[model samples]
Target: MSRKKYILIFFVIILLCLSLVSYSNTTIGRVLRFGPANANDYLEFPYHEISTTSTYFKFGEANLENIVKSRFYDVTYGNNQKVGDLDQFLEDTDTTSFIVIYKDNIIYEKYYNNYNRESIVTSFSISKSFTSALIGIAIDEGYIKSVYDPITDYLPELKKRDPRFSNIKIIDLLHMSSGVSYKEPPDDIYTYFAPDLRKLALEKTQVVEDPGNSFLYNNYNPLFLGMIIERSTGKTVSEYLEEKIWKPIGMEFDGSWSIDANDFEKMESGINCRAIDFAKFGRLYLRKGNWNGKQIISTGWSVASTAPYGPENNEYYPNIPIFKEYPGYYSLMWWGIRRDDKNYDFYAAGNHGQYIYVSPEKNLIIVRNGISYGKGMESEDMSWWPIIFYQFANQFPSE
Candidate 1:
C-alpha cells in the first residue's frame, strides 16, 4: 500500500476510537448523575450519630395487599376526561420516576426508561424539608432547646464573627428568612458540591437586609441549619437523620447523601432515597407524627413546619413566588395551598420535581420523584399535577 493511503487509514481509526470513548463517558456520567443505576454500587452511611433512640419508630408487619386494597382511592378528574396523557407529560419533562400514594397505600408507582424502584434518586432541595423534619424531631426530644434560640447557641463559631448569624433564630432558617445574601441559581451547583460549603456560604458576610424582616430563599439558610445540627449533636446531618428518622421507619433499602470535600453531607441537597421510603415520611405526617402507636415527632411541630408562618399570611415564606395560578404558601419547610373550599393541600417539594404531598383531610399522600434539570424553583413543572391530585382527593366519598 502507498504511504499516503496508510496514513489516512490510521487517522480514521484514531478518530473512531476517540468518538467511542467520548460517547461512553457521557453515558456513564448521565447515569451516575441521578439515581443508583446498579444495586452493587449503592453507598451506605451511619444513621444513629445524629439523634436520640426514642426519636426513631419502627414499622409493624402488615399485609401490603390489604393496605393497598383498603387505603387507596381511584382518583380521576374532569368527568373521567383526559386533561393530558401521562406518557406525553413524562416525556416532555424528562421525568425518571413517578409515585402516587393515597392514604398510606401505593396507588400508582412507575420508573422511567433509565430508572427503577431500587434506584436511589436524588431529592434535591426536598432534602431541605427532610432536614427540617430532623430539626423538628430534635425539638420534640429536647435535644434542641427551641427554634427561637439563636443559631449561635449551637454553632458558636459564628457568634463572634457574624453578629447577624448570632441573632438569627433556628426557626428563621426553616422559613428561609435568615437574611443571608446567597442567591441559589441552577448554575451554582458547584457551591453545594465544593470542598468547603460552609466556608463558601460564610464568605458572604454582608447581609443585604436584617434577618426575620424579609424572605430570601437562600441555600445558606439550610446549610447553616445543618451546621447547627452538627455542632449541637456532634454528628453529621446524615448520621443524625439516619439515627432519628430513617432506620426506625423500616425503610426497605438504605439511602445516602453526597458529602462535600470536607466530608460534610450537603444538607441542602444531598439526600437520596427510594420512592416508597419517601412516602413513609409523608405517611408519618399524615398520621400526625404518630406511627405504629409511637410519637416519633410532636404533631404540633409537624403542623407548624408544614403550615404558613411568614408575614405574607400564606403558609410558606412570602418572598418565593408561587406557581402560576397556584395558591401556594411557604411554611417552616413545607409548601401549603388553599386548593379550594373543599380541598386543602400542603407538600414538601424539592428542586427537580421531588415532592411529598400530604392531605390530612382525605388521608392522602402523593410522592413524585423526577430528574428535572433547570434553575432554582424553575426546574419542575408545578402545575397540572397538583390540580390532578386535588381532583383525585375529591374522588373519595365524603365523610
Candidate 2:
C-alpha cells in the first residue's frame, strides 16, 4: 500500500481541493472569493477584478484638471434619531458616490449603484489620508525632518526588520501610535487584495506595544509612512502623489495607488480617486492647504493635520470609535471630532462607507463613496454617517 504512502495521500487531496475553491462569503459566492464576508463587495467589484489581484500606483496625468459640477441643492432636514434622510441614507448604505462641497459649488451630488462620475473607487484606509498628505508634503519639502524623526530614520529596513520599530516616531506613526503588531480581523484578507500585504508588513509585524504609548489601528503606520515617502522623496507613491497633490490640486481623473506583491506602496489602504477626486481631497483640507491659489499644503500642515493630537489633546479617548462618545483625536493622519461648540471636525475615513467629510467651520465639503456591507461597518453604524453629515452641515449659511 506504500507507493510513498500513495504519493502522500495524493498531496492531501490536492490540499483539500485548494481549500475548497479558495473563496467564499455567499450571495452566489461573492462573484467568486475574497474574504471579510465579501470585503464589502468593494463598490460591487470591478477595478478590473481588483486589478487582477493587486499591484498598483497609477496617479498619472490628471493634466491640469478640476472641472466639477452638480451644484444641486435642497437638503431640508427634520427628524432626529441621529439625523436621517439623505435619500434614506443612500438606500441604506450601498451608496456609490455622494458629494457635497459648499463654498465652491457642487453643493450636493449623487451617483449610486451603477456608480458614476468616472467611477474609480477602492480607497480603503482613505489611503491613510493620502499617506498623511505625503507626510505633510514630506515635512514641507525639507524631505522628512520633523514629526520627530526616527521611523528607523527612513526605514533602515525598519532597523533590520523591526527592532521594536527602532524607537518609532514620525509622530508615533502619525498618531495611530505604532505599537505595530497588526490585527484587524473579521477577515483581514482586506489588505487591498492581499496575496501579500507587503509581506505581512515585513514578516508579521512586531513590537507588541510601546511606540509612544498607544492608539493602535496600525496599518503598519502608513506602511511605514510609505517607506518614509519613498525614502525621503526620490519619487513613487505615484510619483509623490503626482508631483505634490495631483498636478497642483487640479485632479479630475487618472488616479490609483495600491501595491503589495513586492511593489510595496499600499500605504495602509491604497487610494483610487474619483468622486470628484475625493472632493479634491476635501477641497484640499477645506482651503487650508490652498489649491487654486496654489499654496498647496502648509497652512501649517493643514493646521497640524486636523489638530487635536495624541489623546484628544491629552485628555484621552480615541482608538477610532472605541467605546464611542468620541471627543476624538489621533492626528497628522487625520480624524478629529470635538464639537459641542468646541468646534472641530475632520475626516477621511474609508472602508465601506468611504468618506472625506471635512467641514472647516462650516465651509463644508463631503465626499462619500460606498459598498458597505455587514462586517466592515460604517454608514456610521448603518446610516448615521457622522450624524447625517453633522445635520447636513448645519443646513448651510456660514457665508
Candidate 3:
C-alpha cells in the first residue's frame, strides 16, 4: 500500500463517522434506520397491546350454496377492454387480505401472500379514523366539552407558546384543516419515526395560517388530538380506546398500537390487528355505531363523522374526486365517494392500500390490506380502489 492512499482512506472514514454522529437523532437518521413504512411494521417497533373481551361478536357465515367461487369485473385501458376477476386482481395487486361482508354475513374472504385470518397488519393512517372515534367517545362521555372547544383547552402549552394556537378548535383538527405548517417528507418522516412524539408535536408544530382557512392534510393534527385525549380523559390514548371501543365491540383478537420511545400512542397511524377484526369496525359504523343494539358511539357522531361536508368547506385534493365525472369527499378522517344515484359510500383508508370501505345504500362492507398499493396502477389512480368496491357492491341487491 502507499502512504498517501492510506491517509486518504482514513480521512474518508472520519468524514463518514462525523456524518453519522451529526444525523443520528434527526428525522433523516430514523428514515435511514427504518427505511420506508410497510404493512408488517408492528413487528419492528414497540407497541402497547389492546386486549379483547371474553364475549366476542361473530359474523354469520354465508351458506355454501350461495358462496361465490369466482368473480369478475370489467376494466379498460387505451381503448382495450379486459375482464378482471376479484381473486386474480387482488393477487396481482399485492393484496394480503380482502373481505366482503353483507347483511352481517361473510360473503367473500381471501388472503394471499402467506397472510391469513390470524395475521396482523398495521393500519397505517387508518388509525386516524380510530382517533376520531375516540374523540367522539370522549365528548359523549363528558371528558371533552365539545368539538367546538379550542384545542388549547386540553393542550394549553400551545397557547402559552403562541396565542394563535388558541384559535384552533378540535373540529379543525378533525377536518384536517388545523393550519399546522407541515410539509411532506420532512414533517411526515419526523412524526412517523420520532422517538419522543409529544416533544416534536409541541415544539415543531407552528400555526402557518388561520385555523379554519383550508384543508392541508397535516399529520400533526392527530398528534395533538392524541395529546388532547390523553389530557382530558387522564389516560393514555390506548387505555381510552380499550375501555371505550375495543372491549365494548368485542374484538375477536387482541390488537396493538405503536408507541414512541416515551410510550405515547402514534395517533397519526400504527394500529395493528387482524383483517377480520378490522372489518368489525366497519360493521360498527355500518350499523350506525350500534353494536347489536348497544349504542357504543352516538348516532349523531356516527353520521357526522362519515357524512360529506360541502366542498366549499375545505374539501380539497384527495378529498376531491380523482376523476372529474365522479365525486369524492372527506369528513372527520373518513373518505367518501358520492355515487351517481346520489348516495354516499365512505371508507377509512391508510397508506399502502389498507381500507375499510362501507356502502350504506347496498349494505356492504369491503376490507382490503395490501403490501404496496398494488403495482399496475398509476400513483394518482390509487383512489380507484373504492370505485372497484362500488362496482362490487353494485352486484348485490340494495337492502
Q: Residue-wise lDDT of candidate 1 within 107-214, one digit each (tens)?
A: 566677588877877677777888888898878767789999988888666767767677788988888777766644531443443456677565544456667776
**Pairs of colliding residues, candidate 2:** none
Q: For each candidate in turn, give its C-alpha RMSD to the true structure in angstroms.
A: 7.2, 19.6, 2.8
Error of 1 at 147 (Å): 0.4
TM-score against native, each model: 0.74, 0.32, 0.91
Assess the local accuracy of residue 272 in candidate 2 as a C-alpha lDDT between 0 and 100. 70
Better of 1 and 2 by TM-score: 1
Give RMSD (Å) of candidate 1 vs. truth.
7.2
Which regions of candidate 3 deviate over 4 angstroms?
Answer: 1-26, 63-71, 75-83, 311-320, 323-325, 340-342
Against the true structure, candidate 3 reaches a TM-score of: 0.91
Instruction: Write one digit per residue (lDDT tens) for candidate 2, span 61-128.
Output: 22111222211123322233322345554656577887776666674677877888877777787778
Candidate 1 regions off by >4 Å?
1-82, 184-187, 312-325, 339-343, 373-384
lDDT comparing candidate 3 with the true structure: 0.83
Poorest lDDT segment (10 consecutive residues) of candidate 2:
63-72
- After the best TM-score superposition of candidate 1, give how far the Cα of residue 121 lies from its true spot, in angstroms: 0.8
Error of 2 at 288 (Å): 2.8
Question: Best-fitting candidate, measured by TM-score?
Answer: 3
* Candidate 2 lDDT score relative to the true structure: 0.65
* Better by TM-score, candidate 3 or 1: 3
